[model samples]
Target: MGCDGGTIPKRHELVKGPKKVEQVDKNAALIARWNYCAISQRPLRKPIVACELGRLYNKDVVIEYLLDTSPEKCIIETAAHIKNLKDVKELNLTDNPAWKGDKVNTKGDKYEDLQGAAFICPVVGLEMNGRQKFCYLRDCGCVFSERAMKEIKTEVCHKCGKPFKEDDVIILNGNKEEIADLQRKMEERKLKAKLLKKAKKSKAIESCVKSARTEANALSSSSSSTSTTGGKAEKPGKPVSGIAK
Candidate 1:
């Protein structure tokens, strides 16, 4: 249709260009990864746990998933790697004093800080809000910022003072390469456990077989000694009878 009255029609109005691609917001993605459980998509709460791949989850949700006989496909896919409680470590997160968590804003006009984190690193005091890299010790489950770890090089956990090796340090919400490395470590740990179990089983079987052989030998020797004693006694008795006759 022609423009109303003396109005001119712009070329943009007549010709529509290609639609702009809708991109995901970086802040929203960070919030999703740091604040919410990877499996249930619920807000992370106390007694939070993380898997081998460094995905954070609520302990209760993971327990429910493990107990479920027929879990939803999404849940199964998200937590398929978690076989038992041992697969996840309960995070020891330090509470951020500045963070007012889900508190009802008495002043309705006050702006909410979505970037505020619930936890922080005890050492460097960096918020664990996905802005900075964080890691937890597998030996102690104490969380600390990556910066703190690098600055203070020690074998013990900064928060709990528990000794840990280089392999025990697992990065939280790590990148694809870090996740792959963690996966390899996980497989190696499982393999070592299996080999240890097998060795124990074989040792037990060997012990049982040795004990059985010892018992059998003892029985045979006892029976042979009794037969020999009986033969000697019978021979002596026969000789005495012949002499008396």
Candidate 2:
């Protein structure tokens, strides 16, 4: 029976039960992570970079965040806790064959086959759509899959001929174990850079001291020469005075 202005209640409506929470769609989450900036959540544009923690971001947005002094405007506040721009590597992304650029279709549909992955590993062809692990070289900015890296096991980049150190490889969108390993690598790289900077500053200070000492010694020698010449000139003047015939 209906009560007031309400419709009839179902038999199950009278029974009390636990509330069911809506589950998040994994596909949507993956799509978002692959295409959007971790900090600003805007669609990633050219000059894309990855953090040591394996998060994707746009380079220009990162620069703006760094330049902005106000905390309110700072989107990548956690980025400050990061060492510097050196901590992030710019990605060398690959273009997908089946899709057009942002002018046509930036986002893909759920029903249709996903097209235009923002990035892919050059070595193993693993798309950077959050399916597999990927890493980029800090030295050459080349992207490659973790599997390819493990299989190849070389210090140099596969795509580029440039030499790279073990510290130059930084993972992007890595899982828990991979992320932990990446964090360790990041700390080690920063430590090495810090030590190098200190060594350079010490060397500069030593060089300055040496230069100053050399200049002072030259000045002292000049003063002594002038003093001896003056003494000789005084003797000559005296010879022309009372001692002169």
Number of the predicted model whose TM-score against the real structure is largest: 1
Error of 1 at 92 (Å): 1.1
Which residue runs does candidate 1 get wrong by more than 4 Å?
A: 1-21, 71-75, 107-112, 233-245
For residues 1-245, what per-residue lDDT tens digits would candidate 1 score against the true structure?
A: 56778687889988999999999998898889999998899999999999878899999999988888764535556688898999999999999999976776667655545689999999989999999999999877899999999999998888778889999999999988999999999999999999999999999999999999999999999999999988884334435554555
* Per-residue lDDT of 158 in model 2: 86
TM-score of each: 0.84, 0.73
Candidate 2 lDDT, 127-227, residue by residue in tens: 66667777788777888888899999886678877888877777777667987897787777778889999999999999999999999999999999999
Most lDDT-accurate candidate: 1
- List the pairs of residues colliding in candidate 2: none
Write down the worst ten-residue block by lDDT for model 2. 104-113
**Candidate 2: segments with Cα more than 4 A from true spot:** 1-26, 74-78, 82-84, 99-116, 232-245
